[model samples]
Target: MSNLTDMEIFARVVSAGSMSAAGREMNLSPAVISKRIRRLEDKLGTRLLQRTTRQIAMTESGLGFYERVVAILASVEEAEAFVSRGSAQARGTLKVAAPTSFGRLHIAPHLGDFLSQNPDLSVSLDLDDGFVDIVGEGYDLAIRIAELSDSSLVARKLAPVHRILVASPAYIAKFGVPASIEDMAENHVCLAAANQDPWRLMGPEGVVTVRTGAPVKTNSSEVVRECLLAGVGIALRSTWDIGPELRDGRLRLILPQYRASKDVGLHAVYPSRRFLPAKVRVFIDYFAGLYGASPYWDTGLETWLGPVEEARAS
Candidate 1:
C-alpha cells in the first residue's frame, strides 16, 4: 500500500530515536524522512510521533500503530523469505530477550555457532534483568530462568537449574560452617538481589527459613556473585550460573542436605511450536542436549539414582 512505506519509515524513526539516524540507516535524507512521516500523518489523520530536537517519541496512538506495524512488517518479510528460499533456513532477524547474567555468561558465548550455521539469519539479543513482554514487545523468543506463569505462549523445558546456598571458603572458615539451619541465621550474612529475601530451605523432616541481613544489596546477580566470591556474604544462586566457580572451589556449598527452592527453572519460550523456525528449534534442541540429564542441577541425583536402581535390580 502507499501508506506502508510511510509506516515503515515511522517505525524506523521511532526505533532509531531520531529522524537523522533513521535517515542514515535507510540511506535517505532527514528532510525526506520527515516529509514521508508528515505524509503518513496526513493519510492517517493522527499524530503518531511527537518530534523534538533531541529525540522522537511515539504518541499513544503512534505506539499502538507501531506495534501492529512491526508485527505486519515482520510477517511480510518472513513470508517473502520463505517464498524466496523455499527451505528451513530462516532469513530476516530474530529478536531475543534474556536475563543479563545468563545472557553474558551462557547464551552470548553460544550465539557464535548459531550465527555461523545460519548465514542468512541475524539476531538482536537484549539482556536485561527484568521481566519482558515477548509478544507486546515483538520479541521472537525469551530465555527465562523462572517459574513460568500461565500464558498463551508455548514453552519448552530447557534444563533444570538448582538454587544452591554458597559462600567463599574464607567466609566459612572465619564464621564457621553452620551445621544446622538455625545456626545459618546467626553465622551468615545473607546477600540478596532485587529485594529478594533470605532463601527458605526444605529437607526430609521440615522447613526452615534462614533469616539473614545483607550489608550489600544490588539488583544484579553478577554483582551478587562478585560479592559472594569476595567473601562478603553467603548467597543463594542458580547452579547453572555458578558451575565453574563451584568446580574450581572458589565457593563451597553449605548444609547440602537442605535443598534450596526449586521453583525457578530454565525455559525456552516462544509464541508457538506449530511453525517453529529451524533456527529456534535447533537452538532449543542444542540447549536441551547440552544440559538434559547431566544438568547443573543434577549434582548428586545421578549418583544417587544409579545406586538406587542397581539395588532395586539386585
Candidate 2:
C-alpha cells in the first residue's frame, strides 16, 4: 500500500527480470506480485509493463522509474546497516592520509585515544605534503585543510580553518608591531612557507594581498611555526596550529583589522557518500565531537584578544 513497499517490490521485479522470479526471491505468490505492480501503475496513472505469453518487458516510463527505485532501495538498505552496526561495532584497517604538519601536530597526537576507543580498529596513516590519490591509493579517509577542489569524492567539514598573522613576543619587541599590511612589508621580515601562495586577507573595505620574502622558507608548516617562535619573522598561521601559542602568550596575533579569507576548512574526505563504512563514520564522528563549534585549541585565546570581528569593529 505504501509507495516505499511498492517501490521495493518493483525494483525486485526488475532486478529478477520477471514477476515470477521476484515472487520466488521475496517468497510471495506471482499473483501477489502482479496485483502490487498493477496497483502501483494505477496510482501513477500509467502502464508500467507489457506482458506477453513468453515474458514481460518494462515500458519507457517503467524503465525510468525502475532506475530510481533501485537507487532508493540501495539507500534504504545502507541506512539500515549504518544504524545496526553503529560506532561500537566498527572494525577494520582504516588507511588515512593527511598533510605532514597537520597530521603530526593534530591527528597523529590524538590517534592513540581513537585507537583505544575502537580497540578492534587499526590505522595506517600516510603523512606527506605531496598530493595523494585517495581512491587510487586505497585510502579509507583523508584529512584535507585547504580550499577543496570540485571532485566526485564526498567531503564533510570537520572544522573551520582560520589563519592569522602572528609573531613571537620577542620578535614584536625587536621589530615593533606592524600597524598595517603596507607597513609590515617595509619594516618586517615576512616568514613564509616554501609554497609561494600570496597572503590574501579580507578587511572592512576589501581584500588585501601581501607578498614578501623571508630569509628562511621551508615547505613544512612546523618549520614556519618554529621560525616564527625563534623570532625569525611574522607568518600567517592557522588557529589549530598556533592556538596554544597564542593562548599562552608565546605568540602575538597581529593586524586585527584584517582576517584571512577563511576559504579553507578541515575536511574528512572519503570515496562515496552511500554505504559509508563504520570505521570511517566513527573516525569522522570523533573529530566532530572533539572540535564541535569551538575547538579546544581556541580556548582562552578568545578572552585574551576578543573575536576578530569585534576587534575590527572597535
Candidate 3:
C-alpha cells in the first residue's frame, strides 16, 4: 500500500512536470513530494528521475517503471470500482476513439444518454477516420467498422456493416448503370477512399474484383459521399451512411445482385478481456444495445433492397 501510494505520487509528479506543481495539486509541500520520490527510488535501487532547478526528466529505467506503475494503478482503480460500486455504477474518464463520420452520426448523438446514466463517469471521444493505434495512443476503447484482422485486442461485434455499390439516379441516368462488374471502368467513374482497394464483389458465379480507375480519389468518406450525391461517380458506400438517401430514392443501389464481399462489421474493441474496466464494458454494452440487431439507419430499406444479411465476427 505504501509502495502504491509512492507510485501514485511519482506518476503525479511526472504528469505535473515538477515537484512544486505536484505538491500544489496534492496539497503537499515540495520537500515532502521530493522525499517520497527519493524513498521510492531508494526502495527500487535506481534513479527514477533527473531533476534540476529548471526541469525534470525520466531516466530510461524510469520510463519503463512508469509504464508498469500506470497499468498497476489503473488495475487497482478498476478493481475497487467494481467491488465497491458494482458493475452498473461505472466512473472515471474513458478515452475512446472512433471513425469521424460514423462517430459523429451515430455514437455522438447517443453519448448524452450514456453520460446521463453514469453520472460519475466522463468520456473523451477522439474521432479519426484513419486507422488508429489504440494501444499506442492509450485509448480505452475503439469503435471499428471493418473485418478485423488477427489482433491481440478483444473485439465485441456490435452490428453488421453492409456496404453496397451505389450511384445517384442522375449519375445512373447520365452514365448508364453498369451492366456488369467488368463494365464499371468503361462506363462510370469509381470514387474510392484508397486507390489500392478495388471493388471486391461477390456474385452468383463467384467473387470478381474490379478496378474502376480512380477518377476521383479522396481519403475522406464524407468527401466520397458528397461526390456521390453530386453525381460524381459510383462508389461502394456503407448502408449506415446512405440509408436515408436509399430509402428516399435519392440514391439507388447499382449492382443489386452483387454486394461488396468485404466482411466488415461494427466492433467495440478494447485492450483485454481480463479485468476489464467497468466504464469501458458498460459503454460497449450501452452502444451495442442502442444499435441492436438491425440498426435504425438500416431500417425500412429491407423492403426495397431485400433482407440484409448480417456478417458475423470470425
Candidate 4:
C-alpha cells in the first residue's frame, strides 16, 4: 500500500512536470514531496529523475516505469469506476489541443455545459492550426478533422466531416448554378485553398476529380470562406463550417449529388486506447453523444442537400 502511494506520487510528479506542482496538487509541502521521491528512488535503487534548477527530466528507466505505472493507475481507476458505476465523477485537468476555427465554433461554445456537469474537473484548451505533438507536449486529447492515415495514435470518431459543393446566393445569381460537373469545368470558378485543388468527389457516376479554374487561390481557409460569402465562386466546404450560413440562407448548396468521401471525420485523438484517463473519457463521450448520427449543425440541412451518409461512430 505504501509502495502504491509512492508510485502514485511519482506518477503525479511526472504528469504535473515538477515536484512542487505535485505537492501543491496533493496538498503537501515541497520538502515532503522531495523526501518521498528520494525514498522511492532509494527503495528501487535507481535514479528516477534528473533535477536541475530550471526543470526536471525523467531518466530512461523512469520513462519506462512511468508508462507501466500509468497503465496500472488506469486499470485501478477503471476497476473502481466499474464498482462505483453511476457515482463515479471525473476530476482532473484535461489539457486538449484543437484547430483554431473549429474550437471557436464548436468546442468553446459547449464547454460551459461540460464544466457545469463536472464541477471537479478543469480544462486547458490550446487552439492552433499546426499539428501539435500530443504526447511530447502533454496534451490529454487532440481534436482533428481528417481521413486519418497515422496508425500510431488512437482516435474516436466524434462526427462526420462532409464536404459539399456550395455557393452564395449572389454568386449563383450572377454566374448561374453549375448544371453538371462538365459545366463546372467550362463555366464556373472555385474559391478554395490553392493546395486542396483539384477537388475530389464521389459523384453519381463514381469517384472523380475536378480541377476547376480557381482565379482566387490562397492558403488561408478564412480567406476562402469570406470570398465565397462575397459571391466569388463555388467552393467545396465542410458542413460544420458553413452550417449557420446554410441554415440562414446566406450560402446555398450547388451540387447536391456530389460530396467528398465518407471516411473523413472529426476525431478525438489520444495517445493510448488502453490507458485512457477518466477526464479524457468523459470529454470524448460527451462530444460523441453531442454530435451523434445527426449533429445539431447538420439539422435542417437534409431539406437542402438531401440525405447524405454519416459516420458510423460506435
Candidate 5:
C-alpha cells in the first residue's frame, strides 16, 4: 500500500510538473512530497528526476518509467472504480478511440448528451484514420466503421453503413450518367484515397471489382469528399458521411443498383464483453440509440438510398 501510494505521488508530481504543484493537489507539503520522491528513488536505486531550482527534468530512465507508470495508474483507477462503485456506477475517465471523420462528424456532436447523462464519467476521445491497439493502448473502447472484425475485441453494431457511388449533379450533367457498370468504369473518373483503390462494390450480379483512373487522388477522406462535392468525380461514400448533401441535392447517388458489401457497418468495439465498465456501456448504448436501425443520417433518404438491410455485429 505504501509502494502504491508512493507511485501515485510520483505520477502526480510528474503530471503537475512540480513538487509544489503536486503537493497542492495531493494536500501534502513540499517537504513530504520531496521525502516520498527520495524514498521512491532509493527503492529503485536510480535517479528518476534531475532536481534543480528552476525546473525538474526526467532522466532517460524516468521517461520510460513514467509511460509505464501512467498506464499502471490508469489500471489501478479502473479496478478501484469497478470494485468500489460496482458495474452500475460510472465514475472514471473513459478513454475511447474512433475514426477521424466519423468521430468529428457523428460521435463528437453527441458527446454533450452522453456526458450530461453520466456526469460522473469523463471521456478522452482520440481520433485517427487507422485502427488502434485497444487493449495494449489502454483504451476503454473504439468506434469502427468497417467491413471486418477484430478477433481480440468485442463489438456492438451502432448503425448499418451503406457505401454507394455518388456524384455532384453538375458532374453527372456534364459527363452523363453511366448506363452500366462497365460504362462507368470506362468513361467516368473515380476519386479515391490511399488504400481505397480497386473498388470492391457489391452489385446485383454479385461483386464487381473496378480499377479507378482517378483524376484527384489524395490521402485524406475529407479531400475525397471535397472533390466529390466540387464535381470532380464520382466516389464511393457512406451515407453517414454525405447524407446531408444527398438529401439537400448537393450530391446524387450514382450506380444506385450497386452498393458496399453488407459487411460494412458502424460498430463500437471494446476489449471484452465481461464486466463492461458502466462508462463504456452507457456510451455504447447512447450511440446505439442515437443511430439505431434507422439512423438520423438515413432518415430522409428513402427515395435516394431505398431500403437498408439490418446489420448486426456477431
Candidate 6:
C-alpha cells in the first residue's frame, strides 16, 4: 500500500475511533480498513491500536506516533502555503502589552526600527503595570518581568533582569549605609507602589525582611526614579531600569552584602495556538537575538558606575 494511503487510513481510524466508523467515513468496507491498519502496523513493526468490540484505543507508543504525524501534517501544509505565497510577509496589526517601565525604556525605544523593517506591520503597544489577559484582552503578545507560573500560554525567555536595592547618596549620607539586611529596617525607608511589598533579602546567613515606613510610593518606576533622585527613599528595582541613573551617581547601592531576589526573569508571553503567526514569531526571535545572551538588566549598576566613580575620585 502507498504511504499516503496508509497515513490517510491511519488518521481516519484515529479520528473516527473505530475501523467500521472510519470505513463509513471513507466509503470503504470495515474489512478494508482493518487490512490497511494491519499493513501499517507490519511496516512500522508496532501495535498501533488496541481494538475491542466496543471501542478502539491507541497504545502508548501509538499515541506518541500519532502526535508526530499531526505535527508532520501541519508542517506539510505550512510548506505548501509558503511555496504558494512566495514570501511570508506578515501583513496585519500586532497588538502587544508590556509593563510600563520596560515598555517605555526597552521596547518603545526599539519599536521604531521594527516598524521600519516591516512597513506593512502596524503595532499597538499597551503599557500597563498590571497583568493583562493576552487572549481575553486581545493582545498578540505581552512582555512580562516576573517568575512565570505554569500555564497554557507559550512563554519565551527574552532576557534576565536583576533586582537591586538602591538609595540616593544623600539618603545614605543622612542615615548611614546598611551593613546587613537587619540594618535596613532602622536605616532605610521603603519606596514601592500600593499593594507591592518591600523586597526581602536572603544570604548565606539567613533571610531578612526589610520593613520601612512609607516615604514615597508610585506606580511607575520612572516616577520612583524621580523620587529617588529627589532623595525620597531607597528602592529595590530592576538593575536594567536604573543603570543610567546609577552610572551617573543619582542612585547608590544600599546593602552590598545582602542581595534581593535574583529570580526576576524577562519573558515574552503569548497565547498558545496551533499555528503561531509569523509576525509574533519574528518579533520574539528578534527580541531573543537582541537581549537573550546579555540583557542590559543583567549588567549590574556597579559594573557600569564603578569606573566612573574611580575616575571622579582620581
Local accuracy by lDDT, each model: 0.76, 0.79, 0.82, 0.82, 0.82, 0.74
- Residue 33 lDDT in candidate 3: 88
Task: Return the TM-score for candidate 2, rounded to 2 decimals.
Answer: 0.69
Model 2: per-residue Cα lDDT over 76-167, one tens digit each: 65566558776236676888999887888888889999999988789999998887777445577899987898986789998877778889
User: Model 3, 279: alpha-carbon shift in Å?
Assistant: 1.1
Candidate 4 on 1-314: residue-level lDDT in tens?
88888899998888888888888899998789788889999999999999875557999989777766766776678668757766456876889999878899999999999999888789999998777877657787899988888765789999878788899999988999988988986788877786677888777676778885666768777788899999998889998999999989999988777887546889999876465778888999999999976788888886755534421111
The best-first sequence of candidates by lDDT reads 4, 3, 5, 2, 1, 6
Tell me the spans in candidate 1 whose CA falls farther than 4 Å from its real position: 27-47, 92-97, 122-142, 148-157, 198-211, 214-219, 245-250, 257-262, 268-285, 292-314
Model 6 misses residue 24 by how many Å?
A: 41
Residue 179 of model 4 has an lDDT of 87
Task: For candidate 6, write residues 1-314 as lDDT tens digits.
Answer: 28767877887788787889988999999889889889989999999899998678889878766655544544455556567778665546888999888888889889888888878788889999997977545577899988899986889998766666789888877877777666677756777765456566655555566665565655666777777777778787777788877877888876554556435588999876577666677788878887875775545554633332233233
Higher-scoring candidate on TM-score, 1 or 6: 1
User: Taking the tens digit of each residue's C-alpha lDDT, what string does model 3 give over 143-216?
Assistant: 99988998767899998777888999989889888888778866679887773367787666567787765567
Between prediction 5 and prediction 6, which has the larger lDDT?
A: 5
lDDT of 1 at 292: 78
RMSD of each: 5.4, 10.5, 4.4, 5.2, 6.1, 10.0
Ranking by TM-score: 3, 4, 5, 1, 2, 6
TM-score of each: 0.72, 0.69, 0.79, 0.74, 0.73, 0.68
Alpha-carbon runs more than 4 Å astray in model 4? 1-88, 212-215, 305-314
Candidate 5 per-residue C-alpha lDDT over 47-90 given as tens digits, one digit per residue, 9 for 90 to 100: 88898765677898786676566656666666787687675677
Candidate 5 all-Cα RMSD: 6.1
Clashing pairs in 2: none
Which candidate tops TM-score?
Answer: 3
Clash tally, candidates in order: 0, 0, 0, 0, 0, 0
